[model samples]
Each structure stands twice: as structure tokens, then as C-alpha cells.
Target: MNRWPLWAVLTPGEPARLERRVRAALMLEGDEEHGKGPSFEVIPGRGRYHAIVGADSSDVGAEFQIAKDLSREVDEPVYAIDRGNDPWAVTSWRKGVLEVLEVDPESLAESLGCLLPGRELPSDSSSKRPLRKVALVEGIRAQEASRALEDAGDPFPPGHYRFEDTPQGLRVSSETGDVGFADITLSERLPDVMAYGVIASPNLDMFFVNVLRGGECIGHFALPPRDDSFVPAVRDIKGENSPERILAALGIPAEWFRNE
Candidate 1:
């Protein structure tokens, strides 16, 4: 038998309470209301989760909604697992928070590292497989690298993205606006560096301004502060984490950061 491509994973305070909310989220009086074998189900997950299963888990469907809704209701962390898709990702929601992650080593390690601060992932592949499996999901990209954001609409839809180079800095543009990778970000990817970081969000709601070297902050202040970065800001105004503020701080031309 085939496995459900996607399901919600939760470690809840009360399973019975959660199930009731799940039923309500599915908008059914009972399981059979959907006219399928059963409209909804929550089973013991393979690991430390109660996997909430339903007919369809796509964002357009009811399956994933239960995961996010219940997390907020119970003040818990709920994850939506999608095994049937590419660049597999774990959709997580807590309170009103959300993040979509792809199932790769470096990035997945970052996600786990945050969850288990100061802990390191063993080098063995077997031990690392679970994190990879659960975090597996499609990556966020804006538009084909070939296209540009021609409109000024809000809530830009996620699609293919393009990375452009300009005199000011690197540009990660989507269908709606250009996400600025300020000069500091440009410095991170300088001609020679052992490794670096890139932080972004699908809708450009998040961005970071930091230049890490030898595992020291030496420069910026970012939110939810990363474990390995001790960077401090120069006592500037708030919102420096934003593209516009970041660009303003650089004293560079703004044409590259703003939507053309």
C-alpha cells in the first residue's frame, strides 16, 4: 500500500481535545461525512508524534489546516509532513509561527540545531535520516530566474525565482518585489570563504544582515539570535533587518534593492 504523501505531526497536551479540534477543522460532524473510507484520522506516528491523517494535505486542502490550527489552540508545536513531494519539507506552526523547510543536510541541520541548541548531529547517515525525512518538502522559490517582478501587488505568490547581480548587491526577486541582499550579505559570499549563510523567506517577510567569520558575530544583530552568531547592531533604528533599512544602512544606491 502507498503511504499518505502528507500528514500532521504533533506532540499535544491533550490528544482527545486535539482530536475534537481536528474534527472541527475538517468541517465534518463525523469521519464518514466526506463520503470516503473515513474523512479524517489521527494515528500513532512512527516516532514521537500523533500523525493527523486526512484525504488531502495540500495547502489548498483540509489536511494541513488541522496541524496548524491545533498547534495554536493547544500552544504546541505541530508539523505537517509531506513525503510525496520533491525537496520534501516539514511545515511547522506554533502559536502564529510557520516555516517550510527542505530535506537536505546543511539546511536540515540548521533547523534541528535550532530545536536542539548546542547539540550537534552525528556524522552517521542512519542517525540523520529521521530529520531529513520529517523536514522533507518543496523549497520556496519565486519565479523562473529568467523573469522579473512586473507588478506591485501584495502577498506575492510563491514561484520560481531569479538571482540578479547589480552594482549595489545581489538581488533575490520574486513575482512581487526584490528582496535585498545588502552589502553585508554580499560580503558573506565574498570570493573566498570556507562557508557562509543565506536567510530568506518566500514572501520576503524575513531577511538577515550579518557577516560571519571564524564563528563570531563581529557585526550584526538578528532576531531569535542564531546559536553561532554573536553579532551586534550599531545602535540603529528598528527594522534594520528589513531590505529597505538594510539598504539604507549601506549608504549604497537603492535602485538594486527596490522594485524597478
Candidate 2:
């Protein structure tokens, strides 16, 4: 797994202010409501970008989590530099609602928590496998009804960026559009809306679905289940070689498959 470096910088702005914001986010400096998440600094050419440079930066999430809140509140675009020091993911929350979250594969495969603050990622976060660049999904607005982008985090797909909109759902492609494509959808809508994802690694690959209905999940489950190291079943939630229900739940549609 690609470990996160310490001292992430988030920005496209002045260094002093960015520093103060970073410090405050770590609870090491400021007292603003938007002062807590991870860290990253800006680099030229890659505007709205940040970078990290340490290994044991546990509070590393501070840069993103704290800045996310700020983005929502301030209705500005927040940037998080990948540990790879390439392009930072941009999360723009307009009026407390997500406008867009553009990420990269390196960020997702490295760690979903890298993009989503305070979320538990499997040990597979370190997997060296490549993820599908494009994913087709249903059960939510494609690009907030403008472009097709969602801030959903499930590893890979760069938060569903620059995707083409489909009538049934959204078609989120990768930043480069060269890797491959995967279809991800949510059928039930839990209560109102929910987003599902597929996590893939070289060794273990499975669908990571969070049946969020009014902000809660259904019973988590697993199939062909593992006696040891199994998740809560889907909420416990994990699967092995069996995901028919999951596929259906993911809104993959009955006709998409051949055998059924």
C-alpha cells in the first residue's frame, strides 16, 4: 500500500494563510469551524493542489476532513494533494452541498480514507492492483444534474469525475480514461439516496456497498463467507464470489447480465 506522507498541504493560495489553516486544522493553531482535517501545500502548475511528506501522519486526515467542512461552509473549493505529489484532488462544496470531488486512482488505491476523512478502509488499501477508470452508477444525480460527479468514496474512480451522464445514472470515468470501466449502481435508494462502490485489489476484490437510507445502513452481510477476517456481512458487508444480491442492490439491472 502507498502510505500517506505527513504534513499535507491544501491550497492554491498564500503560504502564510495556508500554513495557519493547516496548523488550525491539526488543532495545532486556529479556532475556526473549518479548522480540522489533513494537510497539503500548493505547488505551481497544479493549482488547487496540496501535498504530503511524512509517513506516520495519523492526523493526516486532518487536512481533508477539516478542509471538507470548510469547503462546505465557505462554499469554496478545497484541494488535497496526493501523497504521490501529482495532482491534488479537488472537493468543491457549494452552499454545504457537494458540487464536485475530482480525485485520482493513486489516491483511491492508496487509501479511500485518503479521500474520505474518518472512514475505515480495509487492509487492502495497500493493494497494488489497478482499478477501473470508469464506473457506471445509478440512484443519484449525475453531476448534481450538471456534470456527472459525486463525492462518493469507495476506492478508485476519482470520486466519479468528468463522467458522461446517462439517462439511468452516471458514467464516471477515470482522470485518464485509459485503465478500464466498471459499473456501480444503487437500486433500492435505501431511504432516499445511496452510493455503492467496488474495491479491487490484486488478491481480494469485492463490492463495498453502504446502504445509506436517511443516513443508516441495512444489515451488513457476507457470502461464501470467511470464518476469519470477514466483515460484518456488507454492513458487516463483504463478499466473496457471491454478489448477485449485491449486484441487484447496486442497480446493475437484470438485463445487464447474461445468465442471471
Candidate 3:
């Protein structure tokens, strides 16, 4: 199992949003053919987020060493691929370097040594699996509902979703969006909200940033704070009044804007 660290490039107030943005960017940038899943973990007193791949609890020390080494070049939250079959890859939210590593004990030693600069890899059998499964209905419902809103519009059409209000819990699934490219699934809520963010799609660009409950942005992207910057997109400033004007101000193409 391998673990990689991601250093977020934003302030503390918006870790959740920033984490989502970084995850979204990875989705947008990664090769769909690879079938890679993005999984993350949060650590306190660590200035950045960690993206562990094929990692087990035993590998935390080694993972931290590798992350320390990566800190020199990776100055932002990045997706690090650590499958034994593929060379590790890291992106700093730019067209920057795309590193490839040969899967060998020496390479692992070198990366850790270089990144941690004389640190040691953790030695424990527990470094077996880092990915976990979530089991919750309301949490799952919220994710599905959010995705549904992203697919069509806010307050998703009645028939569009699957909602079961049983004594057990609430469950929701959308027929249209679930089968399309706008696919998103929810397992359970992440207790570490401090390290997560809300998901938003670029299509929300039309609403001029007005996000209604049950609605979310298309695709996910990290939302880190950096020098008070703004994208100037439709979402920057939007409300009930003159929402259309905000869209117009963004110069959204006619094809991209839809009332529904």
C-alpha cells in the first residue's frame, strides 16, 4: 500500500470546499479509462491534506515521510496516484510537472528519502487498506438529491428521484442523472467536515452562483482561499433579484443558460 500527501493552497475557513475542488480537478484531469477512485484522510497539526493510495494504518509513518518530501515541490492540494501497477502522479493545480515513478523498492526509498530528507518509512503490517465504505440513508439521500439538482434544476422533479421514508431511514436515487455523465453516489457523511467541502458543477455557472437547497455545482473542485481571488463566473454574485442580469454579466452563451 502507498500513501501520498496533498498540501492545500487555501486558508482554514474553507477546507471542505477546497477539498472538493481538488477532487473535482482530479476527475476532470484524470484518464477515465484508468478507473481511479479519489480517497482522502485528515491529520491534525499537519499543514496539508493527505491522499493515501493502497495504504494501511501501519504505513502512516512512511506516508508522512513521503508527504514531507513531496512538500518541496507540491505547494498545493494534489492528486497522488500510488497503485503498484502505475507510476505515482502529482499535479499542483497547473500544467506543471507530471511525475512518473518506477515501482521498485529503490524508487520508494528514494522518494521517501528525498521528500522527507532522511526520514524512515513506517514499518507495520496494518498498512493494508485505507479506503472505507459508508452506510447511511439520509447522508446518501443528501448526496443523491444534490446530484439530482445538478443534473436538471433545483427542487428536482418529483418523479426524477427515488425517496423512501421508511422507519429505517431516507434513501434517494435519481433515474435520469444516475444513468448519465452527471453520476455521483453517496455512502455516508464525512465526520471531518473541516477537511471536506461542498460539491459544485461548472454548469451552475448559469445561475450566477445562486445555489438553492438540493442543488449543487457540476463536477467537484477544491475551494481554498488564496489572496482573495474570484473567478468572475456566474456564481460570484447571484440572488433572487436580477439573477438573469448576473448571467448576462457573466456573458454566458445562450446555449449554456436554461431557466429550468
User: TM-score for every candidate vs. truth?
Assistant: 0.36, 0.36, 0.20
- The whole-model C-alpha lDDT of candidate 2 against the native structure comes to 0.36
Model 3 vs. true fold: TM: 0.20
Query: What is the C-alpha lDDT profile of model 1 across 101-209, one tens digit per residue?
Result: 4334224323432211122333543222211100000111223222222221212244433444433333444333322211112222232321122232222233334
Q: Residue 209 of candidate 2: its Cα lDDT?
A: 35
Candidate 3 ranges beyond 4 A from true positions:
1-54, 58-77, 80-132, 137-166, 170-260
RMSD of every prediction: 18.0, 11.7, 18.9
After superposition on all CA atoms, how large is the RMSD of candidate 2? 11.7
What RMSD value applies to candidate 1?
18.0
lDDT per residue as tens, model 3, 42-141: 3221344423332321121122223323444445533333221112222222223222222342243333322211113335322121211111133334
| True-vs-predicted CA distance for residue 172, candidate 1, Å | 13
Candidate 2, residues 134-221: lDDT per residue as tens digits?
2345555554522221223323345534555556455444443321212212222223554333322222243233233332333233
> Which is superior by lDDT, 1 or 3?
1
